[model samples]
Target: MSSPLKSLHFAVFPLPAQGHMVPMMDIARILAHRGATVTILTTPVNAKRFNSVIERAVEAKLKLQVVELQLRLAEVGLPEGCESLDMLSSTDPWFKLLGAFDMLEEPAEQVLRRLSPVPDCIISDNFIPWTSDVARRLSIPRLIFHGPGCFSILCMHIVTSTSVLDGIESDSELFVLPGLPDPIEVTKLQAFGQSKPNATKPQVSDNSEAKTKEKKGYIERVQEGEKAAHGILVNSFEELEPEYAHELAKAKDKKIWCIGPVSLFNKSDLDIAERGNKAAINEHDCLKWLEGREPGSVVYVCLGTLTHTSLEQIIELGLGLEMTDLPFIWCIRNKTEELERWFSESGFEERVGDRGLIIYGWVPQVLILSHRAIGGFLTHCGWNSTLEAVCAGVPMVTWPHFADQFFNEKFIIQVLKVGVRIGVEIPVVMGGEDTAETLVKKEEVKVAVECLMNGGDEGEERKKRAQELAEMAKTAMKDGGSSIRNTTSMIQDITEQLAINV
Candidate 1:
């Protein structure tokens, strides 16, 4: 050695959602373990969430750093609370996201400029395009991390370039996607029939006509910014989606690395039970509840933070679970008052009694999945949940709600064959002027739960597949394995590129 191979400085910008933040944190941890000086930049809110994980990492001697960037919108004339992606979801989501990037550009630049030794490379979320510009201005290499599956990223590229958004009629299925191996249904798209025709950016003028024009102009600019990014990083393993990842690489003439199942890599850095926001939930109560249960007997149910079901639907689900009579740990957010009220009124708490545990607010999802008692997951098919379930060797009962969840459900049931769909029919409403429709009844729920709990021909097959995928996930994270190799290669590539430019 040449100076014992000095550690490189890498900056990460994660999308402000729990799903995005978790995977990005995993990547940050891996880099830190490999002796890279990592700085994770998040908003004040997300920074607080990151503190627990950072503390855990530091305890393990990972040498990770967390930086909180306060986002101000007044100077940019953008709406308040536009600093993070979560704040912009309801109000002009796309533009607010762009505005967030604009807001971060100066602050990020100042932070990097002030550093004694500049960051060797900047890693950014692909969804936010402003990082590319800042990296260019600083003459630093930018690596764009796609926080979703490779197929999802490919779909985004196709939708943006082919004007698919402009042509999509309400409820019309986009049967043929350009780059995908199989046709993707339009309804399954992330925007969920919301991508308007000629949907452009907001205009500078206060007048309606001028605003429409400005909106279009702004959208065009955002698209161009995304296209000009330096390189792309995907949160997926090549073995899982080889064909899709290859297609993405060829579509964008930039270096693409598939470093994923990031949650698996995180296991080595921190205890599973210690991974969540402690302030949000009672981890001790959750673990104690799981401790009494037999191995591979409980069902873990979570619909993620964004997917909200109606009161009637929640009641239906509760009844279904009750009917199944399975030991369950259901993660319910505080917002589901209707469901909570219904449970109270229906004697649901007494019905399940000691057999069920309802965790209100945030749950330590990774811990729950990894527990010995968790046999199957009743999921909403969020990519992060899917990956975690896979890592934990847990089969699933797919109940997709919205966005790319439908696509993920298809992948899990159709492609992977590691889980069973809850049922094709939508859930029916009961009583109170609610229209009764075809629903996955309590009977079907019972059958699925039984199959998952007690091994049968089909259940055994699914169990075997789930176990195989879990092993694959484990192997991918081991030394010199796909995930580790890809992460190491990415760091080396960035370091080399920086050296060449210098």
Candidate 2:
């Protein structure tokens, strides 16, 4: 990697979702730190949410610009204001959302061309496979950014594409895939057994558009696009998956950069530096609940934005948390009426009282995890939440639901050894098979929580491992850390290319 300070602008395009937005914002910041101006390509609705973050970064003197593509719901045949996948009431419109992503290619390309420096490259989310062609059209290098660890990437590639689990027919039947650093016993439930999964991990069918009618599925197109990319930048570090990092790069024969848990370097962290890794939380009342609790006593429960559970399951989950008798902060982001209906009918709110704090919207996840009261995370095992739990050093009660999350749970339980498996394998979203009978019984949830927070030798050992991982994540982003070195090398490589292009 060359060290020439060539001025190269970057266009960081994120898939229009909270999970995609938050991590890519950090990537923009990382590039800005390397002396490059970055423009975040996103939707108008998402832009409004990002304005505050962008404002904060600019306040901290970072060269960050946000360019919104005109993705309106009605224009794309979606409901009004339903720009993000999470914004939708049900996952049925997910196909429309995928189609909408293709619609933004032209608008995104326009932003890239209109920029003064014309941008050196397009760093896009893996979901937006169309951007690789957009980069080709503009004759610029393109890279796909994955918001997961190296282990999750490996599992995603292997579990879905390989015949590794051919023999396992039952849901709990465990088998190990070939070529991983360690043995991971995955169940048939881990597979995309939930109806027909499209090209990407779980699946979403592409709408009838000539542009996307490649005979191949969306995920296949993404893979092909990535194969032609300059590199794949993952939100991970060498310390976590050192062997897999080298193995994946050698296997793909592409320049892979380990430049994350990128969220660690946000300007928001500077304000909370004195308070540790706490970010700003939407619900301030959760903090008050935590004030009286002991350190490592409260359970932090949240099934990410997209996961949807039936009202029955919500009742069971609420009861399960209540049964654990441990103070908890449960963050649920389903429609307000349903959440209220279930909680009211079940007397869940009255039962828990001050013991459990339920937030109906997105709270400051990282900030909450860094709180003194949070001891365990009941998570869906999405990579962002998974990485956040790792960074916070809290043991996870792994309950994976969708996408590469099952594999992420495998990484947390098998590879990282910092989380415990609760065997709640099905996604909450309705559409698949009848899983009502298999809903994680309250006893199962109770036992899982007990296994994580109970004062047992195994639980204590897991807690110790989680704390060790937290320390490694903390040190890896410091001045001389491996992640820092990789980030510097990545920027240098790009600037070197820009020098040649000119």
Candidate 3:
């Protein structure tokens, strides 16, 4: 029989953030591999990041393409190049970025209307909930793409769907998240929108209040969009979090297709190394560094793209890594001149010397994690980073900065037992300023690293568990695996629905 996805067109929209856009691109490629004609909707700046992947897809003769839309940045009072989250300044208000995303709706609708074969479905990032409306207007099914795993999604859903936060007195007060397969303990801050005790709230002027109100509406619309969509496309596999996955599907009453660790879909070395951005360090140089280290003897440190680490924290981290005396590869993003000056003046780099390799920009994180020498990862616990580490069977030193990261850390440390936390007590959202004042000192960092990488029964067990999950992750992508079956079912369901509609 012919593939159900054959000739079916899918217009995929990803929110213009690294975490959001990367997986959505992977999903687009995955769908095209299953014989679907996939068109990715992206902005000019965001589209450039996917050039390599898109080229490879086309070269492989896959029916995949990217449509770059000119976002009305000036109309929204955003700067010309402020298309993605990483491009946003610390001073830029969050609502203005949302306004820029709002501007894409009209152009997106126009593009969808003009496509040669009408899209059978709209697969969109959960953040860009406005795409649901575009799907509605175009009379196509919409599938929400949730980048985080079922654990985080389930926690968020339970908290949002009910008045769980009603009458909560303290941000640190723990409550069991109701209606979950497991009694997951969560604090108000952990859930969402809770503030620290005696914390000075941002002074909201009338104009700022209006913008805040608008942002609230945007969040509500996101939830509404999910409710209205036909299903959710999660970058996860059933074996990874079977209970949470089952619980989430039951709670949402929506078709939840867990088709991921989507990075695995890219089999070629070039595709793997160059998955997101061109490697800042040469891929060969990175591999050469790893090759020199003994098996499971190196610590890989990367705190994801959006994390803004202060120089003080960097020095502390540098000291901690130096203290470990382990072979290490650390990738630093958003490197400031002050950071460079510190490295030059303090001789910190010289002290670490050949024992440590630091890439001051983007590194091929997945490639590095999969290396045999990588013993552990010191990470900010971003979902993409978390999933990548899990697939590589590498344990983590969790230091979550913001968004769903804290929840993801819980899943790693508590549920999976394959990681340890570095004791970041409060969550900090990116507002373009130094939000991560809850600095984890050097002692905590050193201890966490030792706990995850050192020779102890606990450490050995963590490694064993992580390896098991990694095998399961790889298995899920193979034929008859959970992910492959889910992908087929998703396509078949979409095709059957379209037939009924026709």
All models: lDDT? Answer: 0.69, 0.75, 0.83
Candidate with better TM-score, 1 vs 2: 2
Q: Rank the candidates by TM-score, best first.
A: 3, 2, 1
Kindly report which residue stretches of model 3 are placed more than 4 angstroms away from their true locations once superposed.
1-5, 193-207, 433-437
By lDDT, the best candidate is: 3
Predicted model with the maximum TM-score: 3
TM-score of each: 0.84, 0.90, 0.96
lDDT of 2 by residue, 1-502 (tens): 1222655688998887777777787778777876678888877787877666677778878778987777645755787667777776553546567677788878778878888978888899988899999988877888888767787777667766677766566666667778878977666656553433332344443445553454356768888897888988988888888988987887668888887777677535333221211233433555677889999999999988777666667777888899998999887765467767777777777888988877766677777788878999999888889988888889999887666777788888888888877776554332222257457878888989988999489888899998888888878887778888887777778777666766
Deviation (Å) of 291 in candidate 3: 0.5
As for lDDT, the candidate ahead, 2 or 3, is 3
CA lDDT for candidate 1 = 0.69
> In candidate 1, how many Å is residue 165 off?
8.0
Residue pairs that clash (backbone atoms under 3 angstroms), model 3 = 90-432
